[model samples]
Target: MDSSFKGILYPTRLPSFGRFPAPPQVHHLVSWFWIPEWDIAPGRSSRQHLIAFAACNLVVQHDGVELSGPTTRASHQDLSGKGWAVGALLRPAAVPSFTSRPADLRDGRLMIDAPDLLAHVVEVMGKETTARGAEAAAVFAAWLLERVPQVGQEALLANAMAESISNNPDLVRIADVAQQLSVSTRTLQRLAVKYVGLSPSALIRRRRLQEAANQVRTHPGLELAALATQFGYADQAHLANDFQRFLGFTPSSYQKSLTAPL
Candidate 1:
């Protein structure tokens, strides 16, 4: 991805962070990959805030591996001393294949202590947590190929629905997705909650808010009314309500914060 689009959902922090594409075989299951390395000064710590997206993640920390479910709101990650992590941002539809139920994992982190989960990844990463980015990525891909199990037709269909919801900014209602997929709204809702860790409406709202924040960050001067209409909010006031509810700031306030002196 381009630098302009890299930090679309996050505030600028962590001077040493890079995003990489997943390997071809895993592209459908994974959206993109990221590695974050941070060094903090003594007696000082930093916390990075990320406006969450509608996806699960595999976070490989120095100590262990964590499976994070889709978040309904923003997240804050603390950093101290020196450390690095490899994160595989799973597609919204891919969550069920790796875990039992997405709803069980929502708003939570599952510690994957199973040796089966990390044995291949640890071997591939070698004993060095500070490996080069390219080498680490290759290892991660190999681990993915060897460890991440294959998904089924249901997962593939969910992936299509999720991709549609994510790629289409105008998607406002769960009914829209149901109609697109030729399924009933109830079916869509069930699938979303069971496999995506969110209700269908909640997923749609999350994606809309994500796009809104991205636009706010990438185009500070964009008109809120125009943005609301573009992204299917009923009006500017509706957009403001969502921005405040999920992002803890109104659209204009967010824009000003982006432009304020550092």
Candidate 2:
């Protein structure tokens, strides 16, 4: 553990895909880490699994494009961010001309990737803490500060997209809001694609899927047809198709086994 970073154990593991078959266990866990200055983490080392990282400052040095849908280890590196999903709203940096969409920005943080940024963070944090506790957290924060920009318009747009999803997870239409903003639907789509790393529709669908799954888990008795219709699916088949693609489990099986013990 590293003392430079304050580590707090999160209660559940994040949602992800790595193993061919989904793991039987799922817990929501997050590590809150802090780094006062710039630091760097090496790029991912060809490993399985996705990790999520958040920070106030981030930069990029590779070919990252904002893409929607399942991102692989080799490709997930395309999207990145520097702040909380909610906090990016108050920032000023413009959207990245390029980025990696939907992948964990803080996953696989390594010091060798950006040395100058790492130098900046170590200078801010004052000392190393791997001698004590929170080593991963400290190094991770430093790594983010080294890579992500502290402020950007992309952050704001991402925040907006997030807020939009939160308000109505099932409804996402670029035309509705973009025209309201006096921007073309194309412009909004571009913004979401470039800065937020999701098409407006994709973000909406992602949020809806999350909400739908939660409903399924919490209300196992609900009919799939009803749930699917409520969430904007054409019918049960549409819902089932999406559920399998995103979660790796059929909705019925996922619900049936929910109480079998993780």
Local lDDT at 94 for model 2: 28
lDDT of 2 at 149: 35
Model 2 residue runs over 4 Å out of place are: 1-155
Q: Give the per-residue lDDT of model 1 (tens digit) for 173-233.
A: 8878888888888878777776688887877887777777888788877999999998887
The per-residue C-alpha lDDT of model 1 at residue 149 equals 59
Output the lDDT of residue 157, model 2.
56
Q: Write down the lDDT that model 2 would get.
A: 0.40
Which candidate tops lDDT? 1
- Runs in model 1 deviating more than 4 A are 1-10, 114-131
What lDDT does the true structure give each of the candidates? Answer: 0.75, 0.40
Q: Report the poorest 10 consecutive residues by lDDT, candidate 1.
A: 1-10
Q: How well does each candidate superpose onto the true structure, as a TM-score?
A: 0.87, 0.49
Residue 112 in model 2: lDDT: 30
For candidate 1, the per-residue lDDT at 210 reads 72
- Candidate 2 per-residue C-alpha lDDT over 19-119 given as tens digits, one digit per residue, 9 for 90 to 100: 11111120001113222221223452222112111121232222211112222111122212321110011111222322344233222222134455444
Q: How far off is residue 100 in model 2, in Å?
A: 7.8
